[model samples]
Target: MASLSLWLFSGLVLLVGLERVAELIVSNRHASWAFSRGAVERGQGHYPVMVVLHSALLVGAVAEAWLTDRPFLPALGWTMLVIALGSQALRWWCILTLGNQWNTRVIVVPGLPLVRRGPYRFLPHPNYVAVVAEGLALPLVHTAWVTATVFTLANALLLTQRIRVENDALRELAVMS
Candidate 1:
């Protein structure tokens, strides 16, 4: 049962990492297209940190699980798994609604309107909300409480900076349409 849980957790980590990589490829293409049409990217300074932090999140979770010999509490693990699944669904919805506008980095196409579709209709930064939930749920799925807590704290700070930067950029350029 322990090994099965670990394998499942490992698979989850791999799938999430692959998804991020795939998104990055799509984002790079969209970014180029947006740039050709005059999109501007802001908040360049913390971009590397953001990448590193996110990468570390997956790696850390798996490492902590192995190093700490974490046990799978079926009740907690199953609950968290459900939450993580919901988060993934919400994240995908945000990406789909944003379409070509979605990128790992902050890039705003000049004169373009803010996206108010899907989850964004209710939340200003729905992607970040999904990320926060995933950060907590993914780690907790395997009893990696330390990873969960650290990721939540780090992501909170990162999101604060990211959201502020994005909002500032939107105010400077975009209108809700």
Candidate 2:
């Protein structure tokens, strides 16, 4: 049963990784569109680090689960699974709301107004809320507590910098407009 749990968790991670690939495809297309509109990208230095950290998150979760012989506590696992799924739903809502303005990179077009729809209507950085939830919940789904802890801390730091860059760019846009 424990081994089965590990396998199931592995499958879940794989599916999430595939979803990331799909996001990248959409992001690339959106990026091209933004560039055509003379968008300026900020925080390029952190982009690769963000990619590596996120990729490591998936790998580390599975590795920690398998290496530690982590057992799935049905109560915790089921609850976390729901949270993780909810985070994904929120993330997609962000993407759809931003439409062509969204990219994995912080590319903002000058003269465009900030999006105030969907999740953005409530929180300024609603996508980061989804990201934070997923960072913790995904690893906890299989009781990868160490991975969850490390990722939550690292992601918090990264997001601090990311939000600053985004806000700065948005402020510049506002000033220009």
Which residue pairs collide, candidate 1?
none
Instruction: Residues 65-158, candidate 1: write the lDDT tens digits.
Output: 9888899899999999999999989988988999989988899998998888789879999989889999999989899999999989998898
TM-score of 1: 0.96
TM-score of each: 0.96, 0.97
Best by lDDT: 2
- lDDT against true structure, model 1: 0.90
Give the runs in model 2 whose Cα sits over 4 Å from its true position.
174-177
Worst 10 residues of 1 by lDDT: 168-177
Model 2 Cα RMSD, Å?
A: 1.5
What 10-residue stretch in candidate 2 is worst by lDDT? 168-177
Q: Write the per-residue lDDT of candidate 2 for residues 1-177, one digit (tens) a residue.
A: 358889999999999999999999999999999899899999999999999999999999999999999889999999999999999999999999999998899999888988888998899998999999999999999999999999999999999999999999998864432
- TM-score, predicted candidate 2 vs. hidden true structure: 0.97
